[model samples]
Structure formats: structure tokens, C-alpha cells
Target: MLKTVRSVSIADYAKSGVLILPLLSSRKRKAEERRGKTVRKKGQERLLQGNEAIVEGALRAGCRFFAGYPITPATEISELLSVRLPKVDGTFIQMEDEIASLGAVIGASLAGVKSMTATSGPGFSLMQENLGFACIAEVPCVVVNVMRGGPSTGLPTSPSQSDVMQARWGTHGDHPMIVLCPSTIRECYDLTIKAFNLSEKYRNPVILLVDEVIAHMREKIILDGDKPIDIFTRVKPTVPPEWYIPYEDTPTGIPAMADFGEGYRYHVTGLTHDTRGFPTSRPDEVDAFIRRLFRKISQNFTDMQMGEVFQTEDAEVAVIAYGCVARSAKRAVIDARERGIRAGLLKLNTIWPFMRTQVEKILHTSGCVIVPEMNMGQISREVKRVNKGTAKVFTINKVDGTIITPQEILGKIREVC
Candidate 1:
């Protein structure tokens, strides 16, 4: 015989029956199911503008301090973060100019908060001096440069890859730099995270380059909130405040940073300084300081160098491009293959600390290489330097404040083949 089963509430026991508490009510159960769906849906794809993706990626990477001036193409980053940051207990400040913007970012980073700023070509030019200071201080921060045509405000509302060289070399002196070029909305998100990670890991400045087309264009990207991301954080001093040396020499070549208010007595200056953070003009100490700054990057070239090789295996003609131009070149490579041409494309995601090894590899495999840029062939100059007349290299350069087209790249490929 089956035993009888009865469901009773705790209230029934108080009245005169058994004390049985229900775990949940029908209303509560339904509410939980809806919440589960919302959480799962965050892992699905969403249509996002490129700058929006940058904002999302930065928050995902744990950036809590944002200081920047409003500029075309990249304005949405600061505007959106103004509203989003406070909700997460983060700080957002709009500076009077780009110069002040990067300054505040550096100050925030020194206080132990991950920081970033955004601007266009003109504003980027203004920040170069401060960028150099951050380099000497070894402060970690990210700068997002939305490429607009210009030497000095040529095309504020148009797209141009003219800032390629400036992103790497605009700052004064021979400072070590890391610049990332993202060609898609997904890359805009992914690379921004990588930029912050690199900055933190190396204790250096990192720049993420996008263009007007990339900044405003929309694309479907799965920025999965549930997915695990590889984030690198700045190493802090392990020793007590009395023993802390902000710029102490380490085997990894990266000095540990301490928060400003943590009672760590350390100096910070723009001048070439000794490990004690004090200015030293002695040849031995100056040489050591500069060498260590570059050594941090040189020692880790294997991990820092990044690029994508598409259809380059056994190809006769290869096109080297970055940013949105890479998109056109990708299509051109496919079109060339359709017409029975052995054409390939090398898309660079890391622009600086130039991929000499990878570029040489492509040069060896291909008879001819073409570099298409929206500038007057800045990167092509670097390619030619590495080629050194070993390969037939050509360039497709445009500086009329426009982007390179697939037809332009395909025509060059066909001609070369």
C-alpha cells in the first residue's frame, strides 16, 4: 500500500497542525526563471557600435577611472562611461583639454586604479608630451585614438589611418610603446582589453587605434559577460612601506607600483632618474634606467608581437594592412583567389615594436608585397626597410581623408601577380 503524503505550511502548525515550510512560492519561482534567462542572454550576441564595444571592453577589463575630453568619433566612449561608471562606483571626469585628460588618467593609475582616456588625432597630438612623462614614470594607462585625417585638424569628421606612425612615435624621445590596431567591432572590444592588460603587465602606456568608420559602424559581437577573460594587473610592492622602492630593479624588468596614499615613500619625475626615482645625470645610472625601460619590452617581444596571417602560405602576392583597410584587403585577397591568383593578406593587430620577424616571413614566401594605408605610406616605409630590396614591394597610399578600398587593393594584387 502507498503511504499518504501531504504538503503543509508552517502557518498550519501554528494554527494546530504540522510545521512544514515551503521553500518557495509560485511567484518567486517564476521570477527566478526570468532572471536566469536574462543572465544567459548576456552571453549571446548584441549589435554594438565600435566605441560602445570599447566602453564595454574597458569595464570588463576592470577600468575604474576615466578622464578625457570630448572629441569626434571617440566622444561616445566618454559620454557613455559618464553614465555607466558612477553606477559601478567608478570615477569619471571631463578635462578642459586632452592634455589635462591624460594627466588625470596618470594620477588615477598611480593611486592604484586602472585608468583610460580617448581622443582623436588633434587631441592625441596634444597628449604626446604627457604620454612621454607617463613613460618615464612607468604608469599604466590606455589611450584610445580614433583616427581622423590630419597633421593639425585636416578632417575631424572623416576617417584616416594617418595616425599610424604618430601612435607609435608622436611622443618625444625613444620611449618603448605598444599600439594595438583593431579592425572590427569584436576586435575593438577584445583589443581594448588586451591594451589594458599589456599596460598593466609592462607598466607602460598602451594605445588602441580605431578610425571614424570603425568608431561609428555597428556590428554583432558576443561580448559574453559569463566568459572568462585573461586580465593582467600591475604588480604591487611586496615589501613594507619602509622597504618599498617604487622603481626597484627586478629580473622581469618591471618595477612594482604602490598606491599613492599607502604610505609608500617614492618619488616620480619626468627626468631620467635612478632606481630611487631621483634625478641622476650620471652616465651609468642614466644608461641603466633607459635600458631597463626598453628591456622590459625587448625581453618579452615573443608575447607582445601579434599579427594575423591569412592565405599567406605559398602565395605569390601578399597585402599588408591594418585597421579598417585590413577589411578591404581581406576581401581583395578572396577576390584575387577567385580570379586564379595566389594572393594573401597579413593583418596587423599590433602595430608598434614592429613585427619584423613576421613581415620578413611573409616577404620570404611571397614574390611581391603591397602595403595599403590611408596615409602617405608610413608603414610601407617600415616594410621596405625590412625588405631591404629582397622582395618587390609596392604601396597603395591615400591621404584625401578616405579609406583604402578592396578594388584598389585587388587591382594592385592583380598587377603584382
Candidate 2:
């Protein structure tokens, strides 16, 4: 029996008296295939730019407010926020400069918003005063410093890892700091969320030290759905608004923020203050307040140490690096391994409050270490300090307002080997 299976358009069958079609058109089949691709199943892949993914991460992290000034290397962050924030029912404001940018972020955080600002080297320098304010007032916010070369107004278009120390000590005296560095586009997405969580958790500024190279590089990043991200909001005050002392510390360093329209009355100052938030002239009170701010970070040191180890389990030589510099070191490690050398990398994603214990263990076990940075031996000192004269530590430094290429690192590794 050779009876043909007929396919007919329902509309044509309904409107006309003829049995019209035997098969669907290629155009119709192609449309169906296109629709199927768009209907995402349990798992699908995506390619994202480093900056675009950061914007997506910020929105997912409950960051409702952003204020920033335009600066090269990090301007994409602000541009992305401008378009994305409005769609998410959030607010984005462009301030006159980086100083005002951080000032607005602190103010917004105080008004019960998850806030952020982004800048490059020069703007980062300008934001220091307000950064100190956020530290003193215990305001939760994120600052992205897409680093460029510089002492003052240096290379704005190029990449550099020169801001590593600045992220920790830039703001000034006795204030707690947390800085995260990302080596890949995927990490750029993931760490932004983590930065927000740390800021809100500890009631301090969390810096994402991105470099110009990573900020501009495009890559394939899988946005995973199976693993849900853990997001943390600041601990709210248990006491009523009338009884709430804004600067009062709970088990956590953070204090619950009462919106200005609310009836709660509290003061905030860059000057040393008390639980009531009023400025204090007493030296002991100032000392105690500063100590509390720093202790909040030091006490929870375990939570902040983040790094990646590749082939380090049984390696004789280890390369230590962060930011884009780690990218070169990674390839160098691969080359060294192929040549019958036991080489590995300790890639740091968290730069500040240097992971001393982690570095110490590697240094004690490993025969030698190589530190590659875009600046002149900033992190090498920290590595040597942790090594404590146990390991032969070598440094490969570059400060020509450019990235250290993989070949350069390989040459150094060969020389040392």
C-alpha cells in the first residue's frame, strides 16, 4: 500500500475546498529550527565580553544603584550600567568625577541600596577620600578598578598590574580592604558577584582589580544554571528605628541602614565616630573604632583567601601571578611541564590581605618561585616575605605600559630552569 501521507496548511484547508500540500516548505522548517534554538533547554552556552558579563553579574547581585565617571579601560562598565540599570528598574548616575562617583555610591548605600562605581588608575586615585569614608562608615559597595599604567595620568589605553598595592593601601590609615583579581572573562563575571557579596557581608568596599587587557578581551563563558550563586545582604538592625544606633556593631561588622525618609535619626562622619554615629574627639574611642573596622576583615581572613592552583600538587617550581599576568604565567607553566620540568602556577584571584599561609605552604614545598607582574616587583616582595628565605624567589617585571607576553614569561622560566 503506497498511500502518501499528506500535510496540509490548516488555514488553506479551512478557507478552500482543495486538499493542497504533501510536505511543509523549507522556509517553514527553517523557521521551526530557529525557534527551537532559541528555546533554551537545561543547558546551553553563551559567549560574553568581559564588560558585558560584568553588567549582567551586577544586576544579578542586587546592585540597584551605580554612580561613576567615564575613564578609559573602565568606561565600558559605566556605559553598560547606563543601559542595563534602567531596564532592571535600578538607577544609574554619571557624576562629574571619580570623587563624586564614590561619594554618590556611599550615599546610595546608606540609603538602603546595593551600590557600585568603576574607574581606572587616575580616577581610582581621585576616589581615595570617599573610599576612606566608606571604610569608616562601614558602607557596603563595590569598586571596579580596570587598571592602566600610571603614577599620575600615565597610559590610559594600555594594561598594567601596577595598582595591586594601591587597592590595599590607597585609601590610607588602618582601614580594612578586600581586593579580587580575575584572570578570565568567566571570572570577571563570577568575581563581580563575589565582590558584592563580600562587601555586603563585611560592610566594607570590595575592589575588583581588572586590567585593561581582560576588560577588553572577549571569550566564551558558560552561564551555569545548575549552580545557584549565594548572595548576601547586610545584617539589618534588630532594634527599632528609634532605638537603632547606625554605627553599632553586631556579630558582623555591618550595620543595618535605615532609609532617610524613615524616622530613624543617625549621623555619619569620616571623622572617628561612636555607635550613635556622632563624631568623637576622644583618642581612645577613635582607636577602638579603627581597630573594629580592621578586625572585621582580619578576623574573617579565611573567607577572603581565593586562588587557583594548576599542577602545583607535585611541582618543584611555581609561578605566582595575578590579573592578566597570570595568563602569561599559565602558558609558561605548560611549556615548562612539556620540557620535563615540574612547573605550576599559583594564580591569585584575591590580591590583597595577601594569602600568606597559601603562599607560605607553596614556598616551603617548592624549590623556586617566579613572580611576573606588569609593574616592578610589587607582589614579589610579598611572595619573598612569605617565603621567608626558604625558596629561591625570582621576579620578571615589566612597566612599559603594556602586558607581559607569554613568550617573555617562557624565556624567563627557561633562564631560571
Each prediction's Cα lDDT score? 0.86, 0.81
lDDT of 1 by residue, 1-417 (tens): 111112122232122111122344557756865775323233256778999999999999999999999889899999999999999999999999999999999999999999999999999999999999989999999999999999787897799999888988899898999998888888889889999999999999999989888899887776667567699999888888888777877888998888898889788999899988999999998988899999999888777777777778868999989888988887787778778898888888889888888899889889699999998998999999999777999999998877788999999998877
lDDT of 1 at 93: 100
Q: lDDT at 283 for candidate 1?
A: 100
Q: List the residue pairs that clash in candidate 2.
A: none
lDDT of 1: 0.86
The whole-model C-alpha lDDT of candidate 2 against the native structure comes to 0.81
Q: Which stretches of candidate 1 lie over 4 Å from their true place?
A: 1-43
Best by lDDT: 1
Q: Worst ten-residue run, lDDT, model 1?
A: 1-10
